[model samples]
Target: MNTLRIQTRDGRRTDISADTLATLTATLRGRLLTEDAPGYDAARRIWNGMIDRKPALIARCLGASDVVAAVNFAREHELLFSIRGAGHNIAGTAVADGGLMIDLIEMQGIRVDPEARRVWVQPGTTWADVDRETQLHGLVVPGGIVSTTGVSGFTLGGGFGWLTRKWGYTVDLLRSVELVTPDGQFLNVTAESHPDLFWALCGGGGNFGVVTGYEFDAKPLGPTVMAGIVFYSFERAVDLLRHFREITGNAPNELACLFAVRTAPAAPFIPEEQHGKLIVGIAMNYAGPLDDAMRYVDQIRNFDAEPIVDLIRPQQFMEHQKFLDAGQPYGRNYYWKSDFFDRIDDELIDVAVDHWAQITSPLSSSLIMHLGGAGQARPLDSTAVGFRNTEFVFNMQSAWDGDAGSEEHIGWARAMFDAVHPYSGGSSYINFQTEDEGDERVRQSYPAEIYERLVEVKDRYDPTNMFCFNKNIQPSAAVLRRQRADTSPVSD
Candidate 1:
């Protein structure tokens, strides 16, 4: 093969000569895929159907060393590059157009130290992998409702889930990270060793570098827990929400719940008459003892005005983690808008219902994730993830099948987001950022002091802005100028 042409970091044409490419390929244990290589297309596919980026090359990294080599290659050539774990990220930023993609899907390895109560995982590992291992030891790591979501992106972007109320955000439980810096050096970062890098990596997307491994402090919980759902007609949504507000005001930390307004799916549990009809659902998971969690089941049912179906029962924790899988399957076009609130009062409730009435597709949903307890007990500055005071995290999620008429679905989601924006905390969630959201949205997501600190870290590790595909935090102008001044003239 001739020299492989590619785009550089500065958006210009470049080439990795055949010999260079062969040498690079030999240095790694994994395959280096070019545009025409077998499995290249499949390797580039992500969970979101909307993103259709075709990278110039794909690095199918099988392990940590492969990631290191790929990072080094991209840096040495100044090639524009991206990193992919499970490719389940909502924004689909893992694959870049005409750039190098470091695919880590083959690196999905997990190790649990039941004695030490810690779990070490590779970036490509999904939450289900961790849950399966940890739950076997009668313990759990706080993760998302969907089992298939990748652990690295979620944790790095400040994850929240059923156990979030008890164990705090996923970043809170993170003990250390094994990252390959922009310069292609392996670093074992922790609070005690590389505090600055550690702090930034906690919730700071993949802005600094590519993380190969993550270690988190696991919590002892369950192989089984009390978890279920309650359904009600859309007419009673307001009433149910009002009652929910009262419960959330004083609900126990062990109990985590989510309130969603959407058209009910035609599941056997749902009455055939109510299929495809609008309804309000409360998805609850009680990590505490079944005997104790039993008391709150009826209490939750009472919140609904005219209860339609109550599937609340005790089931395996793993099954509970997989509950939302049906609602969010692969290959769906997904656009999300999100915000946090100190409370979910009538004003927000009305706006949510009003928007739910405009849902363009049956797959779309309006949801409010109840957040409190340990996630809020800690101070805001303690971690890179902010929004400590938020009691409810609201999301307008739009998902649909096929490409035809997708524009209108996206427009509907954006409109609903606009209506609910005024009631928000004037900030956005980094994880929920869509491709349309710009740099300003990124800056406002963090506090002034925090954003500046993140900039400082960016300057120190990735001064040239190599990792700009994510929710990027650009290096300050002063740092760029300093680098220029520090540069020595070459006169060999």
Candidate 2:
């Protein structure tokens, strides 16, 4: 190891001697990587190819002990650090430029207690990992639609997926979390234990601490589910979407559906002639009995114009989780803008359709997910997740091959976001927010009271703002004042 220049918590640069770096390396059970390290390049890369940050050091944590060592080292040195799970966040907040990168990707572990209907997952575990284990017993944890999404970041940022309507947001199923605080204390947090901290962890983002493990109350779902996509011609999108809004409004809790507009991909299920043509798709998952699911499928099939492709069928739950994974592969250039909507009205549909026509990239898409069932039944203040009354979420995803057309694709997504924002309920999904959507946009993710409460928790647990990499919530003035007033040294 050599001397390294790293960023500090106060936005200043400082150098650490080789001996100091060696001390940190020796304390870790996992390997530590510097810029010159053989695998450093691949270690720092995240899901979004648009992000190209170079961290000064990377700690590949293997377990809770390694996390504690890394946290203590960073705290003692007053170093700025970011945490990486599966690196699936669109904002690319998992990697910090010229700072310590706590790489948790190697800590994937999951234990399922099927009889108790619960599971404990490591921070690095992806939804696919959890699904693989839980599905053996016909159980599942509410997780993201993409199989590769990290369990920790997704649940902390308010997870939504095909099972959301039936099981509620992922946070709603959380039983407890084992966390390493900024000051180096490891504690198991739960609603019955540290109620305030536990509440903040639910949709509060990663402002408070580094989560080592998550315990969730799993639901009995299936080894097989009736789930797939039904694609329609773009010409009939307006009529089809209006009908989509009607049926979804009355959709049962067991039926979860999402509407999307994008170019058709070349797949066996899609006709070769329709390849590259723009279309609207209604993707659905019915978690109940097979016979009951077909009735809702009939409603979608009854639209005036015939569907260009209807591939709805019985599929393994794990297979359904990977349905959209191909389109959002790692290293793709992705930018997104999103908001919550109370209704999918005519005016909102018109704005969405107009923006859909100007999509700059074939891989880009506009999506509206119907989102009011079991999730909405929870009280608004029950957890850090607000906007429970939200009927749908609108996400404009801009994706392209490389940097040449970055501006054009991002512009299309922004234009559509600005146009459809009028129909929004003045809140947003934190996970879908892009890197450039500044602090004010993050504030928009929660209600006024909820944001204030999150700040309080952040102040209490992370007074110095050590974890400012994610959708950050700064500490209160009083907390900083107390820290400055006390001249006592920080304990390791």
lDDT per model vs. reference: 0.87, 0.90
Best by lDDT: 2
TM-scores of all predicted structures: 0.97, 0.97
Estimate the lDDT of model 2. 0.90
Give the alpha carbon lDDT tens digit for every residue of 1-492 in model 2: 677899998889999999998988889999999999999999999999999999999999999899999999999998999999889999999999999999999999899999999999998889999999999999999887889899989989878889888988899999999999988889999999999999999999888889999999999987889999888999998998998898898899999999988899897878898999899989999989988999999988888887888879999999999988888889989999888888888998888898899999999987888888999889998999976779898889999987798999999999998899888888877888889887888888889999999998987888878898888887887887888779678788
**Clashing residue pairs, backbone N/CA/C < 3 A, model 1:** none
Q: Model 1: per-residue lDDT, tens digit, 1-492?
A: 579998887789797799999998898899999988999888889989889999998999988799889998998898988889889977888988999999898898899999999999998899999999999999899999899999988988889999989879999999999989988889999999999999998777899888999999999887879997888999887888887787677789998888878788988988999999998988899978899998777678776266778878889999989988888888788988888888776898888787788888889887788888899889887778867667888888888998876888888888988887887876567888888888998988888877888898999998988898888889988877787778857667
Worst 10 residues of 2 by lDDT: 483-492
Which pairs clash in model 2? Answer: none
TM-score (C-alpha) between model 1 and the true structure: 0.97
